[model samples]
Target: MKAIIAKSNIGGVITTPPSKSYTIRALLAAALASGQSRIFNPLVADDTEAAAEVLTQLGAGIKRQTDCWEVTGGNLAPPSSPHQKLNCRQSAATLRFLAPICAALQGTSCITFAPGLARRPMTPLFDIFQQLGVRSELTENSLNIHGTGGQFKSNEVSLPGNISSQFISGILMATPLASEGLTIHLTTPAESKNYLRMTIDCLQRFGINVEYDDNLEEFRVEHQAYQPTDYIVEGDWSSASYFLGMGALSGPVTVTGLNADSFQADRFMLNCLRRMGAEVIINGDSVTVNSSPLRKTDTGLNEAIDLLPSVACLAGVSAGESVITGLDRARLKESDRVTAVADNLKQMGIKVIEESDRLTITGGTPRGAVIDSFDDHRIAMAFAMLAAICGDTVIEGAECVNKTYPDFWEDFQKVGGKVSINE
Candidate 1:
């Protein structure tokens, strides 16, 4: 579906969506724990749903209640009857995180996905799985995984930091369950360290112990079992960043249901926006953002790359020029985010310069133009936020926001954003 945005002003209170990061982690832990676990405020986005479906296929009993989900766990088991296919669609987390778990399961399983996922590089993950005695073959759009069920030897494995960190997190999540504990060594500086921290924190919450020495660039997991517990997923800070951008660019918007101390890296948007002259108030689990004259500054936000799309939107509306650096890893995300931002902003008549890793935006009044989302959720939402400043913008492939925020357009509409879908 396509969407058009008319010029509008935004100022209202909106509750953020549940955190996909927390929801997926809780689902994985619940599926691994021995007893039933309750997850509250679970996300119902495509990615989270993919994780739920994958966990269900892995022998976890899932029951969705009115507002919560209960998952009963046991040994990772493939479908009772043999099945040749497990489709993950376009969820990277489900495909990457579930692969090793499926490999460690009792039977053989084959994982397949949509075309976009099929074309994604999986050689790095395949090499790691090979070290664990798991054999996988990549066909047209499927990965045929044959597990030896042999013991996973604990060894030091070095990973390149340029690619998706989910691969490392996937191996880390499965390591504690391995017969021998596993040790992971980082060959280069890990991009998205905050996401890795979220994984480690979730593992500890499930009663698995992981010891890490960042200075030594090593992580060790002990052979242990997970203890199921009630997990509450916080509201998504990444999703909240869009609204925060709107508030910064437009004015006096309040976003609730987000924790001020979220482990999610996108929470750093508070600081970035503050630096750009947005009035930000953080009170425990709530944040209120008010508009102020934004001035461009030189800031490095490598630790908060997930918020780059929205941050780019913020920078686009700010006064003067802003230089956002330390984003060499942004190209490998769901979309090549750097180019996506540059291309979309350029169409809006914003002066955007894209480098190999950094993006420089010369902020000025944006003129309305047609924008392409590149089928990326963040790109869609980021451009939507621009509607407050840029009048009469049309977003092609606007439905891509359903990947993370199914109700994004509706929520934006609630906050005085005039949007109409072109069916």
Candidate 2:
């Protein structure tokens, strides 16, 4: 689908969507728990749906009620009867996290994905799985996993941090079920440490114990079982970043339903915008941001790569050129975000310089152009905000925003932005 966004200044309060990161983890934990688990304020996104389907394939009973999801956890075993192949599409979180859990279950199972995810590198995860005595094979777009129904041996494994942290998080989630537990050692400084923190925090919520030694660079997960509990998913800070950018570009805007102390790395967008001279006020679960003249300065945003797309939008309207660095890891995301942002911005008649790991956006008035989303949700939302400044910007695959925020276009229109969807 394509969408044409007409220019207009943004205003009004927007409630952030439920956190995909937290919802996925909470759903997985509920599936692994021994009893019934209720997940409140769940994120109804494509990725979360993929996770729920995976759990159902692995012998968990899930029922969606009015506003909450009810998950009845059972033994962590693959279906006893013949099962249909699982399709994860392009959800990297589901593929990375569920693959290990599937490998640990008893029975044969296979997972296939669409072109986008099929091409992503899974060799790192394969290596880690091999060390845990799990056998898997990659053929075309399908990954066939056979479980031995045996305990995994604990070992010290070092992983590259520059790729996706989901690799480590997946292994960490499965390690608690190992017979001897597992110790993961990072070979390099881990980027997106905040995400790992979220993973650990979610594991603890489900009754798993994980110990981190920062000085030693080791994360140890003790062998334990997950207990069923009610999990409440908070609002997504990543989604809130777009509205914050809108406020930074036009006028005051308040985003409700986000926690002030979210573990999401994108929450740091508040700090980055403040550092760039935007007036940001946080109250409990809401944040109010007002437009102010921004100053360009070299800012360290390594921990907040998820906010890069929205940050690029804000930077386009800043008074001076802004340099965003330490984002080499962004290439492995849904799209080569670094290149996508630069390419999309340039199409909108903005000057942007791209590097292997950095983006230098020279702030100036934007002009309308047809922009490609690269089939990424964040890309679609980011350019939508840019349209507010550029006027008549057309976004191809704007429906991709349904991956995270299905109501994005409607919410944007409610905030005084006009969008025409072409099916």
Q: Pick the candidate with the highest lDDT.
A: 2
User: How many backbone clashes does every candidate have?
Assistant: 0, 0
Off by over 4 Å in 2: 81-83
Model 1 gets an lDDT of 0.83
Per-candidate local distance difference test: 0.83, 0.84
Per-residue C-alpha lDDT of model 1 across residues 245-315, encoded as one tens digit per residue: 88888867889999886779888888898889999988767788888888886777677887888888878
**Candidate 1: worst-modelled 10 consecutive residues by lDDT:** 147-156
Q: Candidate 1: which stretches are off by over 4 Å?
A: 80-84
Instruction: Estimate the overall C-alpha local distance difference test score of candidate 2.
Output: 0.84
Question: Using Cα atoms with residue i matched to residue i, what is each candidate's TM-score against the true structure?
Answer: 0.96, 0.96
Per-residue lDDT tens digits of candidate 2, residues 1-423?
Answer: 999888887888989999999999898888889999999999998988988887887778889988899999858676565557787877889889888777666767788787888667888888887777777889988888886553665356678775577888888887766667778888887877888889988998888988997743579987788889888999999998998888888868899999888789898888888878999988888899998887775665678888888888788878898999888777877899999999998887779999998999998878898999999999999888889866888899888998899999988987888888999
